[model samples]
Every structure is written in C-alpha cells, then in structure tokens.
Target: MDCLTSKVQISQFLDNELPQELLQPLFYHLGECEECRNFFVRTKVVHEGAKNVEYAAVPKELDEKFAVLEMGEKNVSLMNRKFTISVPTAIYSIGAVIVMVLFIYVSGTIQEKQIAEQYRQTMNLTMPFSEISYDRN
Candidate 1:
C-alpha cells in the first residue's frame, strides 16, 4: 500500500468502512509513512472540531421570501405564452437541414460510383473469353 492508495482509503478508514483484508495493509503503510501519519492526525482533529461546532438556525424571513418568490413564479403563465422564432433564424435552420441532407446524398452517390468502378475493373480482368469469337458452319 503506497501513500497515494492509502490517501484515497484514509477517509473510509477513519469511518471504519474498510474491509478486514485492506485494513491491515493500510495500517502498516500509515505506520511506516510519517507524512501520511501527520495527515491522518490533522484530519482527525478537523473531524473532531466539526463534531463539536454548533450550526446557526434558519431565519423566518428567509422562508417568507422563498414563499413569495415561489408564488410569483407560479403566477407567471409560462406554458400559455407563445415563443416566436425570428424569420432569419428559421431560414438559417432550414438551410442548414437542407445542406446536411444534400451532403449525405452526395456522399452516398460517391460511394456507389466507387463500388461501380471496382466492379467494372474486376469484370474487365476476369472475362478474357468474351473477346474470342468462333466461326461455325
């Protein structure tokens, strides 16, 4: 167990969440590494400090403000309003779609042309008997 691996598992180790297999190796690494040991100590101190600290209560005015904001948001009929796209923007979007379709069509046509060329080459190379004609009575 290196310092990096131990650092990742340190939080879990502090919370007693590591399995028995990992627990021994992690303790061994921490015992050998002084830096990691100090880090673990500082983390423990911070955790203890956080546990002892008191949190402030939420004010009643904040709740009233939030209610007022919520009521104002509800009063606005967003679904009932009509959103209009400008003429130039709508034209540009349609133009983009047209360009995309044309590009796809052109690419498919090019692939078909390439396949046809390959087939023609293969036919020319294999059909040597077609050029020989016989005269029969």
Candidate 2:
C-alpha cells in the first residue's frame, strides 16, 4: 500500500491480476507513483509494437557466408592452437633435459666435494688435547 512497496503490486494490477484487498491500495499507489506509471506505459507501448511486428527469416546466402566464415575461423584457431602446443612442447622438452642434466652434474660435484672434505679431515687428524696449548703472549 505504501508508495515504495507498491511499484511491483501496481505493475501486477496493470496486468489485470489485482486482488480484492489490493485493488484500492494499488490504484492509490499508481496515482502518485510517477516512476511506476512511466514503466507501465513504456512497457505497454513496447508490447503492443512488438505484437504487430513480423520476424524476418535468415537469407540462404547470408547463412552460407556465416557458415564458411565460422569454419575458416575454427580452422585457423585449430592451427594456432597446434602451433602453440608444438612450440612449447619442443622448447620445454629441451629445457627440461638441460635442467635435469645440470641438476645431476651439480649433485655429483657436491658429492665429490663432500668426499674430498672427509678425506682432508681424516688426513688432518687433530692433536691430542694434552699435546696442544694456546700461547698467551
């Protein structure tokens, strides 16, 4: 019944489905609701105009041209997709192999360095605590 709450109810009333209790409130609302009235009139005009119009059928030549263009676009897209895949696959494969080889070589060098350090430690055995002392000069 309130103007703010009556926008939708008034629209329904204009569609001829006014409930017995709502008819008076809906009418009163529409009289003061310029926005709702404008919407109703505009919608009614559009509905009437559309009802009198005819749908035109697509022309055969236009349909055929659209089909050809769509097919050509799809073919070009597929070729582009194939090119994208092939370029990345080849480049990534080579890059992955190079990375793996580098990782293996680095690991081998680290292991060799560790072994050399162990050997050096064993050769440089520390003197006994009793046989060594710091000079306080």
Candidate number of the best TM-score: 1
The residue-by-residue lDDT of candidate 2 on 1-137, one tens digit each, is: 56556766655665677687987766676688787677667867876787899989989989987898889989998878754358789999999999999999999999987886677678784654346588999
What stretches of model 1 exceed 4 Å from their correct place?
62-137
Judged by whole-model lDDT over C-alpha atoms, candidate 1 comes out at 0.84
Q: CA lDDT of 38 in candidate 2? A: 78
**For every model in order, what is the number of clashing pairs?**
0, 0
37-126 in candidate 1: lDDT tens per residue?
988899989878889999887899999878977787767757566789999999999999999999999999999878876876877855
Backbone clashes in candidate 2 total 0
- Steric clash pairs (candidate 1): none
User: What's the TM-score of each model vs. the native?
Assistant: 0.42, 0.32
